[model samples]
Target chain A: MRTITKNGVRIDDTFAEAFPMRGTALILTGPNKRWARQAAVTMTGFATSVIGCGCEASIDGEVEARDTPDGRPGVRVLIFAMSSNDLQTQLVNRVGQCVLTSPGSACFSDLVAADALKVGDLLRYFGDGWQISKKFGNRHFWRVPVMDGEFLCEATTGFTKGAVGGGNLLICGADYEKTLRAAEAAVEAMNEVRDAIMPFPGGIVRSGSKVGSKYKALHASTNDAFCPSLRGMTKTALDDDIGCVLEIVIDGLTEAAVADATRAGLAAIIKLGPRNGARRVSAGNYGGKLGPFHFHLKDLLA
Target chain B: MTLVLTLKVTPPQRLDLSVLLPHLLADKSSKDVAAIDLATTREKITVGDLFRIRAGSAEEIRFEGGSERFDGVGQGLQQGRIFVAGDAGINAGRQMTGGDLVISGNVGPYAGSAMTGGRLEILGNAGDFLGAPREGELNGMSGGLLVLRGAAGRRAGDRLRRGTILIEGDAGDWLGSRLIAGTLIVLGRVGVSPGYLMRRGTIVLAKPPALASTFVDCGQFASSFPAVFGRFLLPESRGAARLFRAPLRKFAGDMAVLGKGEIFVPA
Candidate 1:
């Protein structure tokens, strides 16, 4: 790939290819902001990649009490899956296990779309016939009796079918610390953009993967091409000077959002420059034929 | 264009003005609307006989004047707007699936009965049976909103199946009697025996009332539902939602009936 140097960081011309996915957002409210964020953080835990975790999720943003429907502090969470059915399944399971059990927590839909996932509609059975339903305007909600008090949840949450997933940035540095710093900076910048989320822990992916594995049963395995230790043993994508590589994967409610996040993250890394030990920036994709969305790093700089 | 109907004279007997519904009056000219027949206990009087009709589109029909005898003012209205500048008769906005009905003055008994969907705002006092089911219907006020800015007579919200009733002023005796399922929020004092034989529903009272022996005190607990419910009600009223704060006392009872109904008051 052709490379251009800017702000002391190498920018590859390669693009990140992303697939279309189903995504939804929910607002989890609690008596205070801490509890609401706790529930959101718990529900979004272990949801890093769709290949293994069945979904990708993270806290999109924080909402003030006045901005929320429940008049309580809330956390907005975004979830993405390969299909609508899987999205619904993951949402119901996560909300029921995490938010429902949370004390004084209530869930609401932050997204409004024609397609919907029935979270509270199925969770109400936990009430054992004691659940109460209330409807105001076109929206409906269910109040299920819980040990703490009641778990109030909206009947359905809206989902977008045209979500973009797997938008990424590959950061190569002179050392591990610099690579980590670059990834951290990129994550911080990307987080400011709405409608997108990085599902990884601390928003950095240390163990990135490729589509298939050498093992017969495994659908994916670690990406060895960029491995510093495997550079000599395999056809490596890394240069001799590179010491470490880390990636940031993003999923967004729309293609534009993913594009915006990708541009913002790349800009942040470049701004950090070589003084931060940042060496090069690139993106991973399968021959440009897999995913429909192509976010070219060079074009983003343009 | 807006249809304006001004009552020429106060009729002696209660008139079944349900025919004034949008569907019947829609797409009619001034001559056509004037010839429309209205049902009464005696001979069927034409619309031209009682009111002066300035015809326009049925999308928004206004009554320049109203009376207690103007029964079923906006009944069975599927969609459109009906504004009664003065008092309305019984069952105003009754059984309406959708629309906005504004009664600027008082209404007789059975106001907003058996409404499946719509908005009914009575600016003045309501006689009795507000949001109550009709004589034989199994459910009352199953869907829709009933907002009474003034006081209501006895049995307000009797047999309410589903929907919401917000009373800004005091409500008379037997309020929410036989309430099946729904929410009734009263900002002022409620008369004796609210939720008398209620099967299932919620009655939120601003002022605690005398309870019957059949009711059991459920104690006060911090409930966050009021916050959510209150936010949902902001579009309807400015102060109605503020009445639903947490830490309110709960009472489950009417053991004489199904016993699932609850009454909540400030602890």
Candidate 2:
């Protein structure tokens, strides 16, 4: 496989190694956009990776008032975990703490037709025998009384299949400032794509890790291959001119969504030109053993 | 085609027409439906003696004529649609489990009594005990929807355990009396002692209702229920949803019965 370069930026012939994950989507609507985004941001905060937070969640997109229940502004969030049980636990905890506590916020399951899991059914106990269940059409909702008002939440929705977790892209640049801006551009562009979330802080992961650590207790360690400081100390994958590297981690509802997001991120960085100091875009791979989903950077760019 | 049953002669006495469910008669031929047995005040009479049956197999049955002596018209109906062009006698949809019963005119007492599921629509006035339990029964209508386009008499939704009862016009005394758990929406005025003895349920009134002194007022507040209710109601009844969009004065009552039922009026 030949490495293709676009505008002096090397596109790696390798593919991103993504593993299978159970994912569910939620729509949180509020009286206004501010509150809706507030609850969403809070729910997805600190949820960069399952290794650290037991889930990888972030705001996937925004919803118009006409499209949401209660005709209010809303935000859509996607959360991915290793299993359905893990996803359910994280969903209930995050929605209970972030959404139910937020004033005028109501959470709804995004996948209406999917087999249901008990998210709101479990959370309704917070009402303490005061919760009322109402069926609007075929969807059942629980009205849990809160301090501000009643928080209306939908009960039961399931995870969508084929969600690819840990699709990654590494941006190598001449300096730290250029690398940061390029990564920022990539994150912003990818945020526009549907069915995916970056999950990392500002959608950029600075401390990208490899599969295993030298310590027996740790399953992952820092990637020395692209670390600028470790260039002289370790066998590095970076060229001599590369002084900084930033990785964007993606978890999407489908392989297509991950590919689309990857394309969006790369296009944003490529549009910035080599003058922005971005020299290469390489993906993290584990000799094709990570999972079934392999997003080849070459095919995505082509 | 719709299986039509038209009253041929005014019966001298009332008739028990509970077995004339739409699902049951839909598949019967005209001759077969006419031979159906119906109990009258005097003795059992074939349906051919009281009505003209024009039958064909279909999920729908239409009953014409403003007859007031046909009792128990849609009992135990599980599926299909029944449309009554005029008034009907007592217990129009008793024990109905599933189906849609649309009565375009007034109905006698005990409509939708002990019903477990389905939708019963009364386009005109309703007699007493609408959606209420029978004289000796423990539970009333447990499930299904009862929408009254006109006024309702006393004891409407009495002892109702579940389901929705929407009254587009005024309701007489004892509205929602002894409701176990359900929702009653009254779009117009309501008479005295509303929500009395209700254990747990919601009574939404467009106008302030005369409540018993035992009911406690819980201050005025805005709720998301109206919006939710509006989304569930049909397009023709959208006004009921609009009426609920404003702030409501909530009162939790029936303390005399150790109940937690609530009455909501537009504030």
* Candidate closest to the true structure, highest DockQ: 1
Model 2 residue B114 CA deviation in Å:
2.7
- List model 2 lDDT by residue over A159-194, tens digit each: 876788989999989999988988999999999999
Q: What DockQ values do the models have?
A: 0.59, 0.39
Which residue pairs in candidate 2 collide?
Answer: none
Supply candidate 2's per-residue lDDT for A98.
90
* Model 1 clashing residue pairs (backbone): none
Candidate 1 per-residue lDDT, tens place, B168-236, comes to 999999999999988999988899999999988899998868999988998884556777777777777
Which stretches of model 1 miss by more than 4 angstroms?
B41-44
TM-score of chain B of 1: 0.95
Kindly list the per-residue Cα lDDT of model 1 for residues A1-302, writing each as its tens digit. Answer: 67999988999889999999999999999989899999999999999999889999999999989898877899999999999999999999999999998888999998999998998999999999888887877888988988888898999999999999999999999999999999999999999989999999988898989888889999889999988989889989987779999999999999999999998998899999977857999899998998899998998873
Best by lDDT: 1
Model 2 residue B149 lDDT score = 94
